[model samples]
Structures are given as structure tokens and as C-alpha cells.
Target: MKKMSTDNKLISLLRQSYGTSNPQEAATFLSSAIGRVLKMEKEARRAHITEALKGVDLRRDAGGGMNSKPKTVYKDTKATQEKLAKLEATLQEMKAKYHALLNDGPQTAEENTRLKNRIAELQKSIENQKSQHFQELALLRQHSSNVANASELAALQQQLEDFQELSTQLSDECEQHKTRLKTLEATLEDKTAQVARLKKVMAEVAAGDEANETNVHQLELELANAQEALAVARKQNEEYNDKLLATLDSHLAANHEIDELNAKLVAALDFGQVFADEADHWKNAHDQKYADYEELQRRAEQTQTEVQSKYVDEHQRYKAASRKIDSIIEEKDGLHRQITHVRSLLKFEEQKSSDLTRQLSAARLEMTSMTDDLAQEKRVSELYAKNIRELHDQLALLKNRPVLPDWLFSGSMASGICFGLLFSFSADVAPAQRVLLGVCSGAVAFTVARIITKKNHQ
Candidate 1:
């Protein structure tokens, strides 16, 4: 009866929480919850009774420095939480790097402006050099025309000697510049190799991160499953606690009923004892009052038969009551065994819940680690992207920059120079004609070299 009242109160609370106008649905939910709650409580009581009876050993692990299983689980759970915190910290660092990568756009824009300025400066310098060379050529041509005065002729000769010396020095520098170009080419090759290695590493890291992401997702699903199981176990445990209370109430009520029955049986036995005593007194009184011996003896026999029959019925009734009590005791014993079995099952479930919770924590740690790794991979990939962009920009700038050192065009220019030298040395040709041919060939070679360079760049 008390259990029924408790169920009613619980149902009322649930109905309030449900807050539904449809009472029918609420009643249905109430019925289900009551049944579930009752079942859980009953199971839990049985389990506790089993533990009290020492029917099942809860500790499967006896190789123990630990006092109990729960303490060990607590220690492990605490350790896992600490590791999870560390993983979270690492993940935060990775997030910071990702943000940094996102902020690099402004820096790339600044680099573009710098490259543009450098290009403009190179163009201005090339124009200035061209104008200065043309002015010097004009002055040298005028000087070559007038050399009638000895002093002026001597000065002109000295100027020509200085120009020749400058040409020889420039050739020697060009030879040295060619050797430097070879070394620079080797260094550029090494840099390209390094860049290729970096690209390979980035690709591998990205692939590994992708794999870890998939693994973490699987772990998340498993963790969710474990959590659901744990919730179910907790609900069952609550139901068991409720059932234990209800069973204890029922047992107490049964004990009270047995006590009442025992009291009534004792009262009935006392009344039977008093009635037997009265019958004995009546026999003694009848004997003394009887005058005729034969008549008195017959009356006594008849009373004796009646008294014996009544006593036999009372004995049978007492035996039946005692048997019924014995049956109740046996039933109670059966209940105790069932309770013990339930306790074993409860312990098993508790162990399962603990293991599942531990696995869930481990999965969470793995997921956090995977997330951090993925972030790091993303940051690295972004860095690679930036480096690639800068490299492309540098390559474009190098291609467009003004050509340097006349020897850069030596292939075509050498052909022209050779033709000019051959024409200057020819016995059949006029000096002016040879000079004009040489100049035209030189112009042709320069044009051809420029065209080839442009085509190569394109």
C-alpha cells in the first residue's frame, strides 16, 4: 500500500513535468514508468539480499593491493581526465596557429607592393643607364673628329688607352661573373630540392591527419554508445534501489501479519486448555453426584467420547496452522536466494558501466589529440601554400627583371662579333663598308638575343 502511494506521487510529479493537456498520454507514460521503476527496485533489492547472504563474490580481481574495485576505477578516471586537459591545451595552441595562418593575407599584399616598387626602380635605373651611355657616345664621336693639335692628339690617345684598359677589365669581370652564375645555379638547385622535400612531407602529414580524423569520428560514435549504455545502467540502478525499499516494506508487513496470526493461535490454544480443564472438573462433579452406579458409568463414557472428539479436531487445526507458517518461512528463504542472484547481476552491470566510462574517457582523449593533429596539419599546409605563392612571385619577378651583363646574350652576340671581326680583316672590302657591315651584324645579333630571351620567358 505504501509502495502504491509512492508510485502515485511519482506519477503526479512526472505528469507535471510532462505538462500535457492529454491526460490519457500522461496516464500511459505513468503506467510505463511505474512498471519500470518497480522492476528496477525489485532487482536491486534482490541483489542487495544476495550480497548480505554472501552468495556471490563481488571481487573477481583478488590479486590486489587495492582495497576495492571502485577506488581503482576512480584513480584511473582521474588520470584520464588530467591527460584530456593536456590534450585540450595542445588543441588550443593548434587553433592559435590556424588563426595566424588565416591572418597572413595582409602580409602577402605587402609583399606584392614591395615587388612592384622593386620592378619600377629597375626600370628607372635601366633608362638612366641608357641615356648616360648615349651622351658618352656623342662626346667620344666629337673628340675623334678633331686631333690636329699635338697636345690635343696626345690627350685623345691617352683617353683611347684608358678606354681599352676598361674594356679588358670588364672582360675579366665577366669571366668571374660566369663562375659566380654557375655557383648560384647549384645553390638554386639545392633550394629546389629542399622545397620538393617539404612538399612531400606536407602531403604525408595531410594524409595522416585525414586518417586520424576518420578514426576520431569512429571513436566518437563508440563513446556515444558507451554513454547511452551507462545511462541505462544508472536508470536500472535507481529502479533497483526503489525495488529494494518496496520489498523490505512487503517483508515487514508479512512479519507483522505473521505476528498477528501467531498471537491469535496462542489465544486459541489457551482457550482450548481452559475448556479441557473445565471438562475434567465436570467429570469429577458428575461422578460424585451420580447415585446409580451403572447409570453414572454410561454417562461418563458418553461425555468422554465427546471430549476426545473435540480435542482431536483442535489438535488437527493447530497442526494445519503450524504447517502454513512453515510454508511461509520456506517462501521467504526462496526470496532471499533470488535476491542474491539479482545482486550478482547488479555487480556485473556496475563493472560494465565502469569499464565503458573509462573507454569513453580514453576515446575523448584520442579525439582531442586527433583534432590537434588535424589543426597542425592545416597550419602546415597553409604555410606551404604561402611559401609556394612567394616562390611563384619571386620567379615571376626574376623573369621580368631587366637583363644584366652583355655576356648574357653571348650566344647570338658572339656570332655578330665574329662576323664584324672577319669583315674588318678582309682585304677586298673597304674600311667604311666593313665597319657598317659589322655594326649591322651587331644590331641584328642583339635583336635576335632579345627575341629569344622574351620567347624563353613566355
Candidate 2:
């Protein structure tokens, strides 16, 4: 009965807080509010943990372990803290912007849900990174101390291992950043697509009403400003990427330096070993000087023969190399000559091409002249055809008339008589003979006219 009373009181409190008469709605609001409070508490705890991590310095112990000391490792926790702070600030800014977006206008339920999921994932990733960083710091602290009696080589080995591990961790972090960058790019693309969709919808809406045109235009300007802001953000992300790459490069260079140091140390160790071996050899030789005399003499003779053989071999090799060099020089000269010949050929081909081009131009001009001449001939042919048609019409009219005209006969007779009289006077002929000649000439003229007219008709 007491539990029931307490539940009733809690329900009454939830109803009053939500100002809802419906019990179900009140319960839902209370549940969601409690969830939000729990989430805020988690975030606070994470913040506290990160703050605690900031004070932990991962420094290597500098105690002596050998004659040559290993390089000291100093990793500043402040840089990590700064990065975390920046991330948190960015997250907060995103949350603020998201809240502003929610207040500005209605959004799709799917979009809100997706954004919530993404925020949750980001929080989870940050938590995982924090845990991983804590583990790495613990590992560093664990290995910071060196054994006092350890050899220099052993210390160097340990240092090399530590550097390798650190490089691996850096590589992992770089990969994580790359993945995060890709995710951001994908999110940016989605946002740009969403903006485009919104613009399209606004345009459709604006088309429906002239009264809202001004509002639509204002919205367009706001969208444009948003796009500009997005571009600025993208540019900043690119700058951050460049900075990360530079850091990776620096780490790689440090690793390279470490490798060089290791090589030098190895070389020094080898040289010391060789010096010790040589010293031991000389010391033994001094203790057995007389006993080694014959052995030394035989060894000297053997060395002299070997030297002579080596000298002969070297001379032969020198001769062979000299011959090879001579052959190579001759080959090089031949190649040079070939190259010069090819160049001359290329020049000749170029000249030939120019000549061909000029010929083509001339051919084109000749073709144009030929076409003009053809057109003139066509005009002249047309004129000739017209003249022939006129002549045919005249011939047809002539065929319809008599072969000789009555007027023509009289005119001819008179002209003949006059010509005959002139001939008679000149030759002192009689009037009778002149008249006869005139008559005959007139008759012959009439006959000739008749025949010519008949042929024209035919």
C-alpha cells in the first residue's frame, strides 16, 4: 500500500510537471526527461575523466643504466588535452547549431533520428579514444623505469621497441582521423543534397504564389549564405587535414632519426670488437716471435706470388675495361650521327609538307577559276538557244507565205533594166539587145528568189 502511494505521488508530480492530463503522455515525458538527464550525466562524467587525464605526464625515467644512455621519451599530455578540448568545443558548437536548426523550421523525423544516432556514435567514439589513451599512458608508465645493470645494447633495443610501439599508435591515430574525415565529407555531401532539395521545394512553393515571392527570395539568400558558411567550414577541415599530415610526417622523420642512431651504435660496437681481436692477435705474435719466423717467411713468399698473380689479373681486367670503353665511345658517336641524320630527314619532311600545302592552295584557286568559266559557258549556251528559237519562228512564218513577192519582181525588173542600160552605154550596144538582156536578167532573179525561198520552207 505504501509503494502504491509513492507511485501515485510520482505520477501526480509528472502530471504537474508536464501540464498533461493524459497519464500516458505524462509518463512518456517523464521517461524522456530522465533519459536526457542520464545522458547529460554521462557526458559530465566523461568530461571529468578527460580533465583527470590532463594532469598525467608520460615522462621516461632518466636514471643511468649503461655508459651510453638511451634517448629520453617526453610525451606532453597537454597536447592531447588540447585536442580533446577542441573536440568537445566543436561537439558543443554542433549541438548548438542543431538546436538552432530545430527551432528554425520543421525537419523530417528521419533526419532528426539520423542526426541523433550520429551524435551518439560520436560520443561513443570519443569515449573509446579516451579509454585507449588511458591504456597507452598506463603502458608508457609501466615501461618508463630502466634496470640499472642493463647493457647499453639492451637499453637501445628497449628504446627501439618503445619507438616502434609509439609509431604504431600514431599510425592508428592517423587512420582514425582519416576515417573521421571521410565521414565528415559524406555528411557534408548529404547536407548539400538536402539543401538542394530544400531549394527545389522552395522554388515550387514560390511558383504557387506571388505574395510569397519576396519571402522565397529571402530564403534563397539565406541558403546562399549557408552554402558559403559550409564552404568555409570545408576549407577549415582541409586545413586541419593538412596539419595532421604534417604531424605524421614529423613523426616519421623522428623514427628515421632513431633508425640512424641505432645503425651508428651498431657500427661502433662492431668496430670495438674488431679492435679487440686485432690487439689479441698482436699480443700472441710477440710471445711466439722466434717460432713464427719460418712460418712468416713461407707466408711472405706465398703472399708475393699471390700479389704477382693479382697484378697480372688486374692488368688484364684494365685492358678489357679500356676496350669496352672504346667500343662504348664508338657506339655513342654512331648514335650521335644517327640522331643528326634523323634531324636532317625531319627537316626535309617538313619542307616537303610545306610544299604540298602550297600546291593544295594553288589547286583550290584553279578549281574556283574552272567553276567560274563553266558558269560563263552555261550563260553563253542559254543565249545561243534563245537565238535559235527566234530563227525557227521566222522560218515557220516564211513557209506560210508565197515563194516570191509581187513587189519583189517589179523591183528586180527595174534594177536589172537600169544595170543593163548602163552596160549597153558602156559597151555601145543597141536598145533592143539591152532590153532583151534586162528581161532575161529579171527572169533569172525571180527564179533564184523562188528557189531560195522554197529551200528555206523545206
Each model's lDDT: 0.54, 0.53
lDDT per residue for candidate 2 within 1-458, as digits (tens), equals 97555444444444433454344554565674455335445775465334433534434234442223333323659989899999999999989976764465444778657754664465456446645664676455434422222343354455555555555555555555555555555555555555555555545444543434454455555555555655555565556556545655654565565455556556656788765555555445543543444455555556556555555555555555556556655655655565565555545555555555555555555545544554554555455455555545544554454433344444554465556656765885543454456556655765675577557758
Deviation (Å) of 95 in candidate 2: 99
Q: Which one is best on TM-score?
A: 1
Clashes of each: 8, 0
Poorest lDDT segment (10 consecutive residues) of candidate 1:
65-74
* Candidate 2, pairs of clashing residues: none
Write one digit per residue (lDDT tens) for candidate 1, span 354-387: 5555555555555555555555555555565565
Q: Evaluate residue 68 in candidate 2 and report its C-alpha lDDT on the 0 to 100 scale.
A: 37
How many residue pairs in model 1 have overlapping backbones? 8
